[model samples]
Target: MIVSNPKQKITAVIPIRRGSQRVKDKNLRPFGDTCLMELKIRTLMQVPEIDEIIVNTNSEDAIRIVNECYAVGGVKTYRREEYYASSECSGSEFFRNLGEVTDTDVFMYCPCTSPFVKPETISQCIRAYAERGENDCVSTVSQIKEFLWLDGKPLNYDPSNAPNSQDLPDMVALNFGVTVIGRQDLINNRNIIGKNPRFVVTSDIEAIDIDTPLDFYIAEQIYRKTVIEKLELLE
Candidate 1:
């Protein structure tokens, strides 16, 4: 049971570009009954704490779908510039441009790539951010207790002396499924992860990020096996 605070002006941003290199218009591709972009918008709408949901995209198909389905529920579609839509555009560039669009107390960067990111998880993250008096930002992350390596070097453990998986230091992988940051932080830092950022640890299923075709397939399977099956049982 999450309580909504009316005074907190929270805006959710979902960026979908027209072109996709790996998945080929993955945002508009059919997932279950609705497309990915629509699914994300629908999920965001369920969270009462979010005052506004903004979909920044240059895709006409995305705009049409939003107009047809989600135009009523505090969902606004912004016509993204061609420059920002390019694959060459950096994440910082997007955030910097996004600041000019809406003025809210908090900005939530919600990617449509993670289809399994539930409304409840989002609500909880928003609640955590609002309650965090001193913290500047809150981003969703997945806890990894397994061995980690980078450049053939053990990142989380020593090569010669390895500890048990449970005893090892729990590493957090940033999912980027949901990132909440203040307007000032976005303007100043030009990044989602602020100086004093709090982490919202999420389940592995909830952290499914779809980049390639294989990733999309795996995420879809996980969503069906975990989320949809759970929902069916509840009914």
Candidate 2:
């Protein structure tokens, strides 16, 4: 069947929370010369397809950091309510409110935790959404190795597990590092994945989301190994 791509406008939502369960003031935590939140804001602002970069945050410090770092004038702010501020608050609620305020054909959601997003990744997801006419899309990754799962019962290990990692069957997993949702679907369904969802493939590095102090430290190490070394060469 001949296929036609859907073309739609895109907006970005970067959500930040004041209360961090793992690390204290994690968003404000330093990453080289800038804070973690600032790094994400700056990175998202660089994407040309992003029509608007909205910061859905409850922290005034986070708001101030974005104002100071990002040059994107279309940046909008959403003050998360107390009920919605808790960790219990579903991400869909944030999108629901965002959908109500903004006017865009497609919606993109990024968490403050993942700071090393590339402009190309954003563009690719945007292209996928527009071309495929999918209701929603999220950054995903594939694992080629089998894993052992131990529930409350006995071990659930594969009997014929291969010694080599590359020999195992690949498993594709959603990264939630960069999620894109169609405007109407996000609004009506109040979900990132509405009726139809697409998976936008991305690298493991791009999918690394900081959930704990150790995760943050690992990100820092990766950044130093990859980014800092390059900056040094530019000099």
Candidate 3:
């Protein structure tokens, strides 16, 4: 169980740029009834612990959508600078600027590509961050027990001595679905992952990140099959 602290001010940041090389207009593309960006905004609004939801995007379309539909609550849009909007720009460079954009105690970095990320997961991450005073950052990860290799070499296991799949060490891969970091850490470290970071393991469904056309199709199917159907049944 997670408890919310009213005193802690947390801001949710979603950075959506118009230039997508793989999937054209991926953020603005329709997921179900609404686009991916709108769905993320709506989902973020459900998390009560989040004090404000900031949509940092270079697209004018995104700004218009937020102003027209999601500006009612704690949601606000910020026009991203041209330099920060490019694909060649480093995350640290943009995040450094983000520290200047908002004045919240903590920043919840939520990517719009992760449409399946639940509000419960977001709340849990925030609560874990709050409870763990020693940790400067909390990030969502997917636990994998399967064989992993890099550069044609076994990474998680020894080739000479093979062990049972269950006996293999559980590896946690950063999902980047939800990350909680303090403003001071962002400015100091120039990265979301702080020195002392806590990992929150999430399910495979919740870890689904849409980056390509196939990914988008698969996520749409999952949403319609799982989330939308459940909501319809309740109604």
TM-scores, all candidates, are 0.90, 0.83, 0.93
Residues 95-163, candidate 3: write the lDDT tens digits.
Answer: 888877877888889988998889999999988988877888999999888988988999889979989
Worst lDDT run of 10 residues, candidate 2, spans 1-10
Scored by lDDT, the top model is 3
Error of 2 at 98 (Å): 4.0
Question: How accurate locally is residue 205 in candidate 1, as Cα lDDT from 0 to 100?
Answer: 81
How would you encode candidate 2's per-residue C-alpha lDDT over 1-235 as one tens digit per residue? Answer: 0113235567788777886788777888787666677777778878877777888878888777667656456677777676667867677886677677667777787887877768788777777766665345544443435554566432334456534556545566666767777677778988666576677667778878889889888988888888888899999
Every candidate's lDDT: 0.84, 0.71, 0.87
Tell me how far the alpha carbon of residue 63 in candidate 1 is from the true structure, in angstroms, after superposition. Answer: 0.6
Candidate 1 structure lDDT: 0.84
Q: Which stretches of candidate 2 lie over 4 Å from their true place?
A: 1-7, 91-95, 133-135, 142-144, 148-167
Q: How many pairs of residues collide in model 1?
A: 0
Alpha-carbon runs more than 4 Å astray in model 3: 1-7, 232-235
What would the per-residue lDDT of candidate 1 be over residues 1-235, giving only the tens digit for each residue? 2223556578899989897889998998877666788889888888877888889889998888888878866588899999888878898887788776767878889989988888999988888887777888889999889898888888888869889899889788899999988877887887878988899998888888999999988877766776678888999
